[model samples]
Target: MKKKRKSLFWKFLDGVEKVGNRMPHPVTIFAILCVIVAVVSHITALTGTTVTYQGVDPKTFKAGEVTVKAVSLLNPEGIRYIFTSAVTNFTSFAPLGTVLVAMLGVGVAEETGLISTSLRKLVLSTPKTLITIVVVFAGVMSNIASDAGYVVLVPLGAIIFASVGRHPIAGLAAAFAGVSGGFSANLMIGTIDPLLAGISTEAAHLFRSDVSVTATSNLYFMIVSTFVITALGAFVTEKIVEPRLGEYKGSHTEIVEDITSDEKRGLKYALIAMILFIIGMVLLTAPANAILRDPKTGDILGHSPFMNSIVLIIALFFLVPGVAYGIGAETIKSDKDIVNGMSKAMSTMGSYLVLAFVASQFVAYFSYTKLGTIIAVKGADALEAAGLKGITLILMFVLLTAFINLFMGSASAKWAIMAPIFVPMFMQAGFAPEFTQVAYRIGDSTTNIISPLMNYFAVIVAFASKYDEDSGIGTLISTMVPYSIIFLIGWSILLIIWYFAGWPIGPGAQIFL
Candidate 1:
């Protein structure tokens, strides 16, 4: 009877998965949600109803009158507002701007064949016992180049596993787990560091009139988290995901190729260039009187040129090394070739641009209607009303954020809508913004692999299709669901443990009141 019940449950889940697979892309779904929100907001305005909800302020709640004006979707005024807001929001859209700019240099790396060669060398040299660790580490480190992991490492993982006579899907799963699932944890800081820090700073200001969280506030913790996640990922891949995959008998066989002389030379040049770049950066920031150091405090991270100009610094880090590799490898013969590479990279961003535009507009409309604030305020009020305190409250917030993440994938956008209410509300309840932000990160990241609303979910499905022509959204989601569940449970447990241990979330940032 129990076995029968389990079978029935799986059948029901399969049905739900099929239906979800047929749904629209996350961006389109969110766009539709935006229209619904707009229409409802308009009706609320017409009714002259008072909308009240909990906000960042636990004591005082967000209260507003719904007011909407009928404006033609095609009219100049309406179009102007939409377009203007969309552009403004897009400019501030954390991932888009950071990824695009970062790619300028990363394109050079890939165009020069540095990244490809490096990946090949790593895979070829690593032993079978350490393959999972290598794959996970590569995935974690790939964030340095933004989308490079999804575009390069994920496919490479499959190829590597196939070469080793392991299941390619298992390799893909392991790599994907690291790249997307463990995105928030990395040894080195990436463009997201500053983006999230800026948002946290803005939210923190609600409580403290003149407070700011530096981009590297969480740097030390994240560096430690990288190894922890990599180890955990390796364990999961070997013990669970790989075992579930069973064996590799795919129609498309793996091809094992020797590393070419040109590739080796290119990698050598890239390494040299990277070393030089690192040395230069260290010199610029190391000394007490170094230019990159903070002028007043002489701190490297708090208020330094290195952190302030990190975007440009990252751009140069990749560009200089990549250009050197290209020159040495003779892949880039002219400026035109370099330009073409960057152009190619930009071409891939077309879908993201569309998604960003729609997402931005929706977010703007939601904010305009004052609905997000109201929802956040009301939610916070209920939690406060329940008298939940301490670690329990943090865990509750983590679960709440995770649930919300299922429907809303964009971290910054969700935080934009959530932080104003949760941050201040939690602060009033004796919790800090840093703690709330940390909890949100844990929730946001663990579900990214399974969230259909995630922009890259389609891309992942497409990747899966390369192996199994019959693969669809259902296949991809089912394959990844286990990872999502494991990550959520494991990550939440870690957060709870950290909270109880009273660990600092960041530099001068506390996990407690």
Candidate 2:
């Protein structure tokens, strides 16, 4: 008999797994990248590489051919920066502070059993046929609360799936797909919206000072994408992901314990607190002269305290409900319990802190060297010379962003680097800045599930290990590849349809400048 052969798809997946397994830890990867950036900076400087741009230099008011050259980071000054700025770099890392603050509140809920009981109640109350859809939808919406979704919904999804006798990993995959893969898509404005929009606005200023982008620039498209992700997530889970896993062979220990009366009371208390909180927020922003609205224009979305304090607001949103639940359940009998809950949350972040420190240094060095800007400018110039237009131009940009996203995971950081170059290029090519921003978002979000550089990738792996002790980066990547491919394709098709239809991506946002 002839030897049997595995399918090319399986073989490719195996190769990916092997490659990923052979790769060093993310912290080690950043350390290597730091050295690479330093060396590349010196080499470029030695070669006298520079880029001359036709746009107005933000540092100068004049519009001319401003030359940008790479700064060598291998000199004595560079060596000094490496040692002296280490502390500030780690402390100022954008995700570090946001994540820690958000986790403080989430940690309280998780520690007090509020999250577990609430999720259980939600799953049990939902119709069985809609469980997959609900979990996926919840995951998509969780972005509004920032990183809390990753910590709570991902593992909860696995528990919910296992409780129904399905493969636990499948559920985790679904939630991960929605949380990370659909990161930029949400029914409501999220912290990411303002963050990316601010960067985009700055980039747009390079082309025209009169132009500006709002936080809601992609709101309409993101709302539609939320549904697209929900449907795709459910389909992939039931048809592709779940079927591939076959059956669950793991213990169901992660499932919530039998719902006690005290837990029910806690949930009741949390619900009440959440309802009251929403009402208060509504009062704060819904009426004319609302306290949270912009004092000058009375706008909630622009230059407003509400937008500025969203992270803190989200923290409070979780904290109030959590404390209410804890009190009701007696999990927090004293103020010391609250402190302990917060401490426990911070404790889980030891590994993340180490990774963040190295990653921060890499980001700082990359920014300092001006290498990222030069690459963006050169890349844009090359792309423009290709003479692409319409759908071809849009799709190419999406692919370019997707490829870049594989190496750099922070959406804001990548946008900050690429926007100044591409935003102007797109404008000169007759495309709108918001259109380019949306395409970048599609690319950025789809690849987040696979990128090891993403801040939360390690956490997702930890969640998976709970079900299968042997699960590693390769396992997560292989499982998530289908989602990534589907999301990219489906989302691309939707963009094309919208483009041909000439639909606005958001309020007053068009496809062409």
Candidate 3:
């Protein structure tokens, strides 16, 4: 008897999954990376490899040429830093606090049946023709509330898809594509906008002290991108990913339907609570003397407490609605249910916590070694020396950024390092800082879905594992590759078109210097 052989595509995917699964857990990989960083720093430092670039002197606040050299972590000072900074590193890891805090509220919503009910209602009510678009668009818009999208929408997409008898993993991929792949594209300004803009401002200051980059610098393009990503995500999910997935035959078949009268009442109460919450937020930020606004400047966007506390605000929005729904439905009879919900959410994060601790150390050590900065500077210098102009140069820069994004997970951190070099260089070549910044953003966002080093990658695998017990990082990445590739091509073409048409990428942000 002859056995059937697998095709090349499946063989390749199998190879990827086998290889990825055979590797150590992400925590162990990070620990290994930390050791590797230490060893590489010694080798580089011993070789006296160095790179110098124009940068702002942190202490002096003046533009000057700064030389970076790899510092070995095998030394006494390095050993001291490793020991003393361990606790701080873990504590300071940004995603840790954000995910944990956000989950505290989401925990209540999920446990009290609010989230499930809401998602079910949304899916059931949406038109069949628009289901894919709605799911993808919701995922894109969810970025406005920060990491809540990852914790809530990704799984919700799966549930919704499965309810409709579609492939759950396909739905998960679509949502993940929009949430992570379209992270930088939103109709509204997100925390990431101001954070990245602040870093861009700092980098731009290296060339011109008076240069400023605002949160809205990328607004118009991002708004257009919101649609671009939504359309692409929906198209890919329907035409490519879903077809590949076919029918889901997994054991997890729980679907929410036929909503009970109590659940209906609960949803009404939740909606009212959410409305009130929004009204409260409006009152806080809509007035000149509002508490959440900037005390000194009376601004809501820049250096404002309102922007800083958006996460907490979102948590309250969720918490309030969950409690309201619970009260209406009598599902949560006591505080113990609320406490249990929060505890359950935290329990699921056990693996994430371990990964975060190790990842934090690796990130800190990499920064300490100055390798990322050197690599970024070197890359930027190479691109600058290429002497290309117009669309050719712009496209090259975008490609370079996309390539670099594979290694660095933090967009702000990577931009902070690259912008000082590229912003100045592009300006010298008669391109606006905003133009270069947008190019970087397109690259940064497109690669996030494919990058295993991304902070949320492990979390995503955990989410997918709920449906397919064998789903691993490779499975997730393979599912996401279509989105990543399409997004990259589509976004890059959009940028080129915007460039050729001589349009403003944002308010007062021109394509040329």
Candidate 4:
């Protein structure tokens, strides 16, 4: 018997996984980058490197010529600043507190069993014909609790399909596609929203010191994308992935368990609590002299008390319903349960805290050295020279991010590096920081299902192996390629439409500067 041969495409993908897997941890990578910045800054400063841009004059604070030059972090002043600012950098990093606060509420919801029960009810209640769509949609929505979707919904999808005598791997593919590939598209602003917005704001500081990117910056776009990803995910699963997967042959059986009576009672309590909360918000923001509105401007979304309160509102949004559900379900007999939930959530941040510390230093160094602004000017100049302006420039950036995502997984880590260069570059090319962030997200999300570097990619493979028994990276990637391809193409087309239409991507977030 002759051994089987693999195609060039599979070989290429295999090589990609191997190379990505060999890379150092993201924190170590950032640490290496910090040193590189110090050395590069020294060289650039010695060479008297500078770029003059037509923008606000730094000294005069007027719209005029601005010249920027690299500053060496290895110098005495720079070294002292770095040593002194390390703690400040870590503490003042915007995303750090945003994530920590948001997770507290989400952690309560998860610990109270509200999120899991809600998902189970949603998926189980679907009609037989709509199982695929429901599973995928639930997977998309499950992002509210971070990694819960991968750990819960993906396997539950397999169990659901197996119960219906369908191919379990197909179900797994659909769920994985939605959970990972549709990560950036959610009906609600998730932990990632404020997290990325903070980084974008830091990056935007390169061009304009007063700029602030809000968590709702991409809210409208995210709303549209949720349905887009859901439709695309379901379509690919039924039309392409399911057909390829065929019928299940292995003897695997599992039951689709529905939410219990206690869980049902808890859900109802959560719903009532949520409705009342919304009513309260409307009363606060809908009146002409609303308390949450700007005191003089009568505006809610602009420079108002409401806009600034978004992070707090988000925390309470989950906390309110979460506490209600806990009481109804008898999960939280006292306040200690809530405290425990919050602590558990913070415990998960051990790795993120480390990564954020190093990344904050890296971002600080980049800003202190003026490399970010100089590069932005240079990159924008080059793009202008190449006629890659407007739509073309944005499209090309989406492609570049998508390609880079295959080798690097952590979205925050990648954005922390890319934003310092690209966000300001896009702003210089006449795009808003929010819009640039949106394009980056479209690319980052669509490639996640196929990327071997995605943190949950191995977990997905493990789910698949439970059904197929012989499944590996190739098995999972091949199953997900259709989703990744269609999702990228379809989502890009939607973004193009948004660009040409010039619609506001979110609250106060226009595509152009």
lDDT of 2: 0.80
Best by lDDT: 3
Give the poorly placed runs of model 3, Cα more than 4 Å off.
Answer: 1-14, 56-63, 194-214
Worst 10 residues of 1 by lDDT: 55-64
Winner of 2 and 3 under TM-score: 3
lDDT string for model 2 (232-252, tens) is: 989988876776566778775
TM-score of each: 0.70, 0.84, 0.91, 0.62
List lDDT for all candidates, in order.
0.69, 0.80, 0.82, 0.78
Q: Between candidates 1 and 2, name the one with more favorable lDDT.
A: 2
Query: What would the per-residue lDDT of candidate 3 be over residues 1-513, giving only the tens digit for each residue?
Result: 012115565456557767766777656777888999899988888898899877643323345567888888888988999999999989998778878888888889988999888878877788867888988998999988767788778877888888777888888888999999998899988777876776667777766778787878999999999999999999999976776655789976657587899999999999999999999899999987999999998978645898678668767878899999998888999999889988998888887788778888888888888877777777888898898988899899888888788777777777766777888877777887888889999989898988866777767777787788776767777788879889999999999899989999888888886
Model 1 — TM-score against the truth? 0.70
For residues 1-513, write the lDDT of model 4, one tens digit per residue. Answer: 011115464455455544543556556766887999899999999999988765532222233345778898988998998899999988986556656677788789878977667656655676878989888998999876565677557866886777676888888888888898899999988768867887788778888898989989999999999999999999998876776566688988645567778878999999999999999999999999999998998866534787677656777888899999999989999999999988997786675677778877776787788776565455545544665778888887777778767756667756765676677888988899999999999888988888754655645655576676556556777778878889999999999999999999999999998
Top-down lDDT ranking: 3, 2, 4, 1
Question: For model 3, what is the error of residue 344's alpha carbon versus the real structure, in angstroms, after optimal superposition?
Answer: 2.3
Which of candidates 2 and 3 reaches a greater lDDT? Answer: 3
